[model samples]
Target chain A: MKENIFPAIRLTVICLLFFSGIYTLIVWGVAQFSTNAGKGEIIKQDNKIYYANVGQKFTNDNYFYSRPSAVAYNAAGAGGSNKGPSNPDYLKDVQARIDTFLVHNPGINKSDIPSDLVTASGSGLDPHISVQAANVQVKRIAKIRGIAEGNLQQLIISNTEKPLLGFLGTERINLLKLNIALDNLK
Target chain B: MNTEITGIILMYAAVVAMAIPLGKYIGKVFSNEKTWLDKIFNPADKVFFKLSGINPLKEMNWKQHLVALLTINLIWFLLCMFVLMNMSWLPLNPDSNASMSADLAFNTSISFISNTNLQHYSGETGMSYLGQLVVMLFQFISAGCGIAIAAVVFFAMKETTAGKLGNFYFLFVRSCTRILFPIALVVSILLLFNGVPMTFDGKDPITNLQGDTVQISRGPVAAFVAIKQIGTNGGGFFGPNSAHPLENPSYFTNIIETISLFLIPIAMVFALGYVLKRRKLAWTIFSVMTIGFLLLLIPTVINEMNGNPAIAKMGIAQPMGSMEGKEVRFGSAASAYWAINTTVTSNGSVNAMHDSLTPLSGMNALLGMMVNCFYGGVGVGFLNFYIFIILAVFISGLMVGRTPEFLGKKIEAREMKIAMIIALLHPLLILAGTAIASYLYAHSPVAYAGWLNNPGYHGFSEMLYEFTSSSANNGSGFEGLGDNTPFWNIACGIVMLLARFLPIIGPVSIAGILANKKYIPESAGTLKTDTATFGLMVFAVIAIVAALSFFPALVLGPIAEYFSIY
Candidate 1:
């Protein structure tokens, strides 16, 4: 028992030093080659900085819709609402989101609202919306922005992120990028 | 789009391509053969052995190996628990996080030691830098311990008429230095270069476009995330886990993280072939596991891609499938694939919320953990599958009127009893734990704080998923359970320990005892496990055991939730 206990404890201390101290420093050194040096990808547009990797809330109808966030797109405290589907509060929140969307897009049916638009993402700040989510709001955004629906559709098609390997994930659009494009539309 | 496909193809190609050689390299490492890295790591190995008083050349029998494995694990557990409970005074604690409650510390220590990494506390705010390092250190050692024990099992399975398996301490050290360290270092650098933060500083404050200030938690995340996936210890550096922008910044990083989860587990399968000089048998087992993995993966992907029918009824089109809990970068397909991959291998990191998944997809994840043998954790996966193979051989032996013999060892009551108990123990712990939790939730008002956040079927599913994940030693949870309470912290701690150690002991003991038996030449009538028929039979046995044990729980939870959702 002593042989086992003493050696195990000694080896563990050595491993702890190597993996936690030395190995982490090595990884930190390699992070120097990465974009932003692991400080996060920051995009400066019109002198305002935006984290290109994080979800940004865009509530105005003239722009493409962003996914709902339980944390209000707070990158500092990223998380889902941790609410179960049947939780009345969560269900009410979704219902309220559905109501708000219907009021903005009068022609859209309640059943036609994508769940992504109404429900908060697990990472409270999901930057992308399903291709269907973008499409459902296309009518509302075109009417408000006065851009031709055809041109908007073209932009959506161009921005669609295909599943990796055409087999890994579903197609979706980065709402931040799409809204930025919407503001730039001539 | 085409480039995305290319990336996926390249990643899969890379894992198999690299794993084949990695498997052979691992084989050589354990056999004490001369290798290139031995010059660097050999001296370190001797230092380790000397400090621990382990004789590298002295082989231990199965019992001694088990004793060594358990004692060392306990030592690490004690060390980790001490650090966790006393992190307030520990150095490098920039955040000055307080010590964890005794219950949480016990749960966390056991979780990491068992290679489960089931985190009940949110990491960013809950743990200081000192605590993070403590957790990261345990990740490496625990994963190494698993591989070491697995090496012993492989040795026991192969060496006929030898009473001794290899040295546990030697295998543990070699596993870390040769296999886990190199792969983890490479992965860490890859992730660091892909934008995962690797700083030692405290949380950074950033003001967003909305004019709201937020504190961005930064740490040695790249180092932790690398081994978290590579070692199959899926605890996150942050609360949202890999879904965080800094943890998994881009599509490329997501692919890397997902691939890392399966890489070592898959390599271990190939290593079995190389070590035993039985490539056919290894490939057959690999096929059985992969087929099971793919079967679950495809349905989960399709269900998630189909989106939720309840939301569909609200007149919203689900053209991009289900995106409820998934990130846009990951998409429904990738997130579903991750769900299946992580659960199948005991890698519990999540890029999306399992709780938000559609009913059938949720069930697919549950079933993967329930079976708990597909691909599996680094070294322990094959150990679990070996149990089913032994049972299959025993049952088939009875039908053919031949005494069951595995690798020249006669199967007897003692061996069968251990295997049965080990196999039976998994479901017993899972179901019993869930039953107790459910009862407490109903009868005891004191147990009702944050226990079930959702009522009805989804609520039941959350409780059920927790126990299944714990009992399988796959620590990903539904994220909806308020599991930080004393009731949960202690219950799951006990479950994770028993679930992890018992399965390991059962297989290694059987193999160790068998290795000592007298050799008998193979006859024509002897069962060939490498053949397709026998592989299918083993698969059937796994499916049957899983089905018989978990069907009621599944029906009451995910299946019921599915019907309710539709």
Candidate 2:
């Protein structure tokens, strides 16, 4: 045991330097050539900047809402509501969200609302919503903006990202980009 | 087929495909056979040994290996504790995050060093850059330690006479340099290209289109996440793990990270086959583990894709399935697939919140940890499965009225005692720990109100899952459990320590003892361990042991919740 201790200590020190210092430096150096220089992907529009991947709050009637955020889309920290399926209080919260969605879009029935629209996401900063989530909100956005609903539908279709290789992952739309496209419409 | 199902199929295909070749390479590294990358790593490993003033070729018995593993792990624990508690004033803490409380430090340190990675604190707020780096160090070494010990056991299995196993330091260094480092580098670069951050800068404050000012946390996440998945450490750079947008970024990055979770563990099985010169044995073991994994996985995917029944009653279409605590990009199918993969392997890094999974799906996650040997965590995973193999061998031998021998060595009462104790220890720790917590929660519901996020059956599950994860050294949590308190921190700390070392000690000791015994060559009377019949026996042993012990707890938690909701 005593003989092993010094070797263990020496090895630990060397490993700490190799893994923490050198390996991290290599990754950091390579990241300098990556997108946005590894500061994360960012987008600038009309003097406002947004993280291309980070979800944002979109409660206004003029924009498509991202999924509900447990941390209110606070990027400083990420979390989920962690509410179990059978929890009455969590179900109540979902019910409230559904009622609110119905209130916003008068013609859209409750069944038309996708579950993603009412439920909070795991990361609280999920940038994308299912295509169906964006589609359901087009009516409210069109009615408020006084744009033809057909144009908004076209925007949704264009912004919709197909599943990777058309077979791996889900079809979704980036809420931040879609809303930016909404404002860019002439 | 739907994209979600197709996505899962592709992910599994990619993992198995990668694991086969990687497993062969790992086998070569341990066997000291020449490999393509040996030129680069051989000299690099020599530096590590010289710096440590140790000879790489020095022979170590099983006891020496355990001592070395534990001592270094202890040092790592102290180093991690110091960094975490003092990072507020330490260099490179750009976020200006405060230091952790003593109890939290204890939990975090033990959690990482044991390879559990059960986080009591959120990374973005609780950890500074320096702290993240230190934890990342553990992510590499702890995993290397596990892989090294597994190599030791492999050596023990191959020897026909009492002899020293290979040096622990040599195997450990080689594991980090030749295997973990190269893989992590490739994965990290891929993540960086996909927008996972790799910077030492402070948070980027950005104003969204809504005119809301949000401080976007960014750091060396790509590197951290790469090792986290590859090592099966599962400690995230952020609290939400892979679900965090900046941490995972896109579906492509998601596929990469998910594949990493299965890579080394599945490879280790093949490595065992390679080292033992028993390819059929490896396939048999792989089949057994894959069977268990699919059993848990298929149900979880189906349940998650079915969405929540209670929400369905409220008249909403769940075209995307259950979305609470899940991301739209990965969808329910991928998230559920990741959930089962993470648990079964003891990877414990969630792409979605396990707490919010449907009751049956959540139960499957728990069962994965409860069974705890389906693929499992890197090197230690095989150690857990080895215990089952011994138990099965003993029981089947008794049933057939023959003395048990495995791999040409006799299995006697000493080995059976160790195997039984180690197998039973998992349940004992989980059950006892949960029992104590339940008593506390029930005895003073008002005082411990914050202990549970949901009431009734699901709440019981949160407690059960926590202890099971700790005992299994699987760190994914039912995060709803407000578990940052002193009770949880200290309780889980001790549990993680005991669970991590004891299981390793049990298996290595058994193998070491058996290796020293006289080599009894296989005869007509000897049982064939590599046969499909033996594989079935092992599977039956795991099912009976894990299911019988954990069923009552499951009844109270997810099963009750399932019936109540549906």
Candidate 3:
């Protein structure tokens, strides 16, 4: 028994190192094995950094915008605040977010708000907004970015992700990737 | 949205079927008696014990040992609960959210503290920063618990008698501070590089097309998500779960999370076998699990990608397969992959809603959580696989007309009976619970029954599935079932205790039995369990045992949909 036990402990250690070594190798492989197709940047403005890939631009043209967040992330603090909408301060914060949006883009009606717009996301640091929210901004984005309105709308349409096997989540557009691409257009 | 209740039930069943072999493979790995792997890590274990101020040389029997281990764990569990309860006053509260309700907090505390990250509320508004730190921190610790338990079991059966059972706090701390944390940190960085956001401040409101101001939400997501997957905590930081663009961010990030989900579970098997000096034995279990994962994931993704003819008839042109509740970035294949990965180990966070999947696809996910999720928790998964090995030795010994011996230890009648009891416990809990719930109570605590939300057989199945999942420490729930009732609450509590301990007791008993056995000399005629042939036998035993226990449940759940899919 004594003979067997010592060997076993020794054996277990080698096994752990070996597997972790392989995992490290595989992870290294994934890091080394990228398609190298696209690249993006995290551009900061007004203390908030949005994802900005190279060759991409933020254009209002034909893109939909999703909901607003009270507490948010940008690559660094990218997680949800886990704050509920029912907090006494929650709605007040939403109103403040609405006011901020008005300062950025003047002249949208309150009724045109996307459901996700006022609602807190599971993760406040979400990179994609609901497609519905994106559509709420399509006309204004189209008018702002100044390409043909239909052409801009087509871009947002192109970015939308359909649900899994046709039925998991609503179609969505990546705010970071789309905004970067939008900048490229202009 | 018309909830496809039947479809969800089907996929749930199928996923369970795939998980059984996974359970076996994981068990076989950590059962090693001695290897180079053990020699290396054992020192660290000793160091940890000494650092924690426990004597490293102390030796205790199984009962005293479990008591110490459980006492330590219970203290940690309480500490975790305390963090959640007091999140409102914590400094990590960048969002400054309120503390969770007592019930909700209890559920969350146990859910994540057990490595079963089932959320009773939306993430964005439910928890404060401190709650996440404590609860999600427990995710790493919980998996460590699984790993440490297996390590203890390993020492128990290992021929060596010297050395501590291992420093529980060290195992917990290292798993978080070393393995899980570093990987999560790197993965989060990569995710950020790939455009996933990470921030502490709120997103500033930006004006949109129709001129309405909308506050775009953002937070410290990348790192949290990275650890969530690594630690096998599927509780979404976002309310919409992983599908939220904020949570998932990019296709690159998606791939990282997918791979991370499988990382520890798969590697543990390698470690287990290597330590046991039976790498091939581990490989066999791995093969069975990987094959099962591929089988379920591939077909589920394919079917979902096929696009629902129902929608096509209306000329809506479903975007290539089961796109409902899936991210456009990931599409069907990725969703299928995520589904398989999550349920492969009882981590049930989905990028897409299982409630909306196809009947067959849904069944696959369900089956994985049920049976194939043998790799359910980090350490527990392998422990289950060990039971299968013992069972295989017993059955095969009868077949070849020789007394069954595993690793030169005789497979006695008592050991066989104990192994068989633990082996069947999961299915028994899952099926019996499902049957009773479906037959007696179909209404969720909150209910409005519509055809889309059938409250009969399908609804009942959902309730049963959720309970089975929770008790089994599998976190995936049939979201359609309002399972927050006292019945579910109490029943699941019992189930969790039983599911976790039954399998553990089996192995502990075996280890005790093995501690007394004398090693027999290997002979040419001795059928070695460490070989490829034995691996296949072990694999067969796991598959057969799972089939026997849950075939009826499958027929009632996922297989029923297989017949229904026209």
Candidate 4:
């Protein structure tokens, strides 16, 4: 055991240097060529900067509300509600979200609301919502912004992201980008 | 089929296709054979040995290997504790995160060094950049350590006479440099392009369209995430793990990360086959593991996609299935696939929250850890399966009234005793740990009221899953449990230590003993271990020993919850 100790300590130090120092430096160097130079992808809109991938809270009636967040879309410390499927209090929260969505968009029934819009995501900072989730909110946004419902529908269609390779994921729209596009519309 | 279903199928295909060749490469690497990467890594490895003053040529028996493994792990544990506890004042702490409490540090350090990675603290606010890097170092070495010990077992199995197993440092260094490093490099770059942050810069505060100011946590995520996936460490750069958008940016990245979880584990099985010159044996083992894996996976995918029936009772459409704690980009199918894969491999990184999964799916995840041998964690995974193999060989030999011999080495009473103890240890730790926590909670509900986020059956599952994860060295959790308190921290730390070391020691000791025994040539009456019948025997042993032991505890938790919900 004594004989193994020195070598163990030595090997660990060398490993710390190689893996923690050298390997990390190599990856960090390569990231210099990536989006936003690997600080994270950023969007500059209306003289304000935003993380393109991180979700933002958009509760205003004029904007397309992002999915409910457990951390209130706090990117600094991301997490989910971690609510179990059968938790009565959690179910109450989901039902409350449904009722609120119905109240905000009078014409749309509760059955039309997508679960993504009501339930909190794992990361709390999920950037995208399903296309169905986006479509259900068209009436609320159109009325609040005094824009034609067709143009809002057109905007949803144009912004909707197709699955990878046309058949590898769900169709979804980034709510932050979609909301930014809404603000830009005449 | 819908895109979600197709996506999972393609990911599985990609992993198996890639693992076959990677397995061969790994086999060659451990055997000291010339490989394509040897020109580059040979000199690099020389520098490491020289710096460490370790003579890679000095051979060690299994006892020596364990000594080296445990000693180095202890050093790492101390170093990790120091960094985690002092990172607030350490260099490179751009986030200004506070130092960890002693109990939290104990849990975190043990968690990473054991390769279980059951995080008691959220990464974004809880860890500094320095702390993250130190944790990342453990991610590489702990996995390398597991792989190296496995290489020793492989060597022992392949030996025809009593001889020293290869040097532990040589195998361990080679694992990190030759195997884990290069793959992590490629995966890191892929993640970088897909927008996982890799800078040393601090958090970026931004204003959204709604004019709300939010602080976006950014750091050396790309480098951290790559090793986290490849090593089966499953520690995350952020609290949400792969479910976080930045950690796993898109579906394409999701496919890349998910494939990585299964890559080294499946490859290790094939590596065993290559080293032993027994392709049929490898295939039999792979088939049995795959069958066990699929049994857990299929039900989970169905349940997660079917959505929560309780949620369905409310008037809303769940076309995307159980979206609570799941992202839209990956959807329910891929998330369910990941849940089972992560648990089965002991990778433990979740793309979706496990606590939010439907009850049966949650049970399947628990069962994956309980059955813990299906494609298992890096090198240690195969070691866990080795115990089952030993037990199977012994039991079958007893049934057929023949002496038990594995690859011509007799498995006597000593090996059987060791295997039985190790096999029983898993259930013992999980059941006993959960019992204590449950007793504490039941006796004083108000005192421990904060312990659970959910009430009743599902809450009971949170405690059960924690110990099962710790015992299996699989780090993914139900996450709803308030686990940072001293009770949980100390309890799980000890469990992880015992689980990680004892399992490695048991298998290696057995293999070392077997390698030293007199070789007996295969006779007409020798039990054919490589055959399908033998595979069935091994499967039955695993089912009876690992799975059945956890049945009552599971019934009380997930099964009861499943019936109550549906």
Q: Give the poorly placed runs of model 1, Cα more than 4 Å off.
A: A45-48, A60-63, A82-92, A107-113, A131-172, A177-186, B1-14, B50-53, B445-449
Winner on TM-score between 2 and 3 is: 2
Residues B113-220 of candidate 1: C-alpha lDDT, one tens digit per residue: 999999989887689888998899888888998888888888877846377777888898899888888889988888887778777777666665545666666778
- Candidate 1's clash total is 9
Error of 4 at B43 (Å): 0.9
TM-scores for all predictions: 0.94, 0.99, 0.72, 0.99
Per residue, candidate 4 scores C-alpha lDDT tens digits across A19-75 of: 999999999889888878998898899778888888899888888888899999879
Which one is best on lDDT? 4
Ranking by lDDT: 4, 2, 1, 3
| Lowest lDDT 10-residue stretch of candidate 3 chain B | B448-457
Please write out the lDDT profile of model 2 over residues B293-403, one tens digit for every residue. Answer: 999999999999999999999988999888899999999999999999999988899999999999999999999999989999999999999999999999999999999
Ten contiguous residues minimizing lDDT sum, candidate 4 chain A: A46-55
Note the clash tally of each candidate. Answer: 9, 0, 159, 0
Q: lDDT tens string, model 3, B1-566? A: 41132233334444344333433434333332333335545675565444445543445555544555455445555665676778888776766678766666666666775677776665666676546545555666667667766666666545453333443343443444345545666776677556555554544444432244444545555556776787667777766567666566555566567666666676677656655655576677777666666777778867776754333332323343544444445556667767777887777677765654656676677767766444656777778777877887778889999988876667788888888788778887877776666645445433423211333234444555676677557676555455455556556655665776667667876766765677666677677776667767876776676667766766776555445433
Winner by lDDT between candidate 4 and candidate 1: 4
lDDT of each: 0.82, 0.92, 0.57, 0.93
Candidate 2 C-alpha error for residue B19, in Å: 1.0
Best by DockQ: 2
Models, CA RMSD each: 2.7, 0.8, 10.6, 0.9
Query: Which window of ten consecutive residues has the lowest lDDT sum in model 1 chain B?
Result: B1-10
Give candidate 2's total backbone clashes: 0
Per-candidate DockQ vs. reference: 0.47, 0.90, 0.06, 0.89
